[model samples]
Target: MDSPEITEAMDALRRRLVPGTRTILGIAGTPGSGKSTFATWIQQQFGPGTAVVVPMDGFHLGNAVIEGTPLRRRKGAIDTFDAGGYLSLLRRLVRRDEPVVYAPEFRRTLDEPVAASIAVPADIPLVITEGNYLLADQEPWKEVRAQLDEVWFVDTPQELRLHRLVARHVSFGMDPAAAVAWAAGPDEANALLIQATRPAADRIIPWEQELE
Candidate 1:
């Protein structure tokens, strides 16, 4: 869908592209709002050689680290991520110094981050990073905003978002009832926190309407 909102975001990122420098575009939204999908679409629009997506989910604290702790229950919460490490990676991406930078990828089936799974080459002019907390007003998270050329918040309907979250959980091995519980519980809580940061985004895309 080449909607105006999508086109505008594309143009904004295109403007940031320079001969020797890289531009980082951040797509933030509540869980299940399709930020990752949107980021992928943007990458395809720009072509793989020109744009690559480096997700924040790759920084999630491993299940082993959260096991036997309260974090295990709130696995997708803000504190469940390696904020410092993500910030460090963003800094490196902004500097554009390396020939190739490897990034971690989150595996939903394993529920852990696989190290060095994504490779961001120096020639790629645009890097699109999507996640739930890119606009979060916290220590290292706020620093994440500084490294991005532009941050767009994807706004999806709450009902649609919750439905997507439940379906995602079920697809990933949770029972139907358990998926519903999770969507209404931890995921909803995270969604609320993410939504609160909407005012800070450079652009707020009505995802359901625009992307449909």
Candidate 2:
């Protein structure tokens, strides 16, 4: 989207805030739909010190934990995340009383979560968190929506999304054939789940339009 459009959205979000309280803006989308890219654009627009981007990828369960369970093959499925832990962090961010709150970050190369990697200071008024399940209706996930001031669903063409997902799997070490298979299989399943939560969002962001 153009700078004016972005600024207007940000302005509208800010208008919902009461002085002295922090607000979280959630960007929810299917895998490869550019949620992270949009969140980064928001952070850049707000500039440093005023905002921070805390991603949901950090809450992914360790490989060891996943390998021991039925969820072993479904690494990106809803059950593969630490939903309670993520919820706790959201609570902390809303409280914002701590001098600084530390959050984990996911290392794509290692496919692991590194603790205390993202530091959210007391002074930052806005926290942009993006993920696939923020608007899910399943138990704890359903509660996640209440923690955020607003959630925006990112919409991208299914074919393009799947292509990017396959490329991402390849970049992360999967063989080309295996990557395409996994993207079409597991990733596509998760994408369907994510899409069901679209109506739960406060706004819909057109991914292709934004790129233009």
Candidate 3:
């Protein structure tokens, strides 16, 4: 979206705010659908201190936890995350009791979660969290919808999203052929699951419409 349009959307979200309460806005979509980019844009509109971005990727179970388990091969699957921990953080964010709440962050290069990397202060009114499973219907995941005031699903053409996913994998150290294979395999599988949760989102954001 253009700057003005982004500002307008941010304003609409702000209008939903209630005094002394914090709101979480979820940006959900399949891998490479631009959820993270859109969430970052929204955070920029709000600026520092007014809002923060707490990505669901941050809650990914470390390599240690998944190693030698069935989940190791399915790293990006819903089962690979620490769902309970993520839920607890959301609960705390809603209560707004603590002066500062720390959130973990996922490092793409290291392929591991860094503990307490992002801090959400008490006064920040909006928390923008982006991920693939926010609208999922499965246990633990089903409860994710309840923690957010609003959820926006980013939609992009399947071909383009797949291309982006492949490129992303390559950029992160995978060989071109391996990147393409992984994107078409595991990434596509997760995308199918995430796509099934689309109807549950509060809004659908077309990638072209939002970024053009």
Off by over 4 Å in 3: 3-8, 209-212
Local distance difference test, candidate 2: 0.87
**Superposition TM-score, candidate 2 onto the true structure:** 0.93
* Each prediction's TM-score versus the true structure: 0.96, 0.93, 0.93
Best by TM-score: 1
Candidate-wise lDDT, in order: 0.89, 0.87, 0.87
lDDT per residue as tens, model 3, 62-134: 9999999989878999999999899999999988989999999999999999999999999988899999999
lDDT string for model 2 (1-212, tens) is 65454556778976865557788999999998989888888788765687899999999999888887879789889999999999999999998889999999999999999999999998888999999999999889978888998999888898888778887888889999999989888888999999998998888887753331
True-structure lDDT of candidate 3: 0.87
Q: Can you list the residue pairs that collide in candidate 2?
A: 1-210
Model 2 Cα shift for residue 26 (angstroms) = 0.6
For candidate 1, give the lDDT. Answer: 0.89
Rate residue 141 of model 2 by lDDT: 91
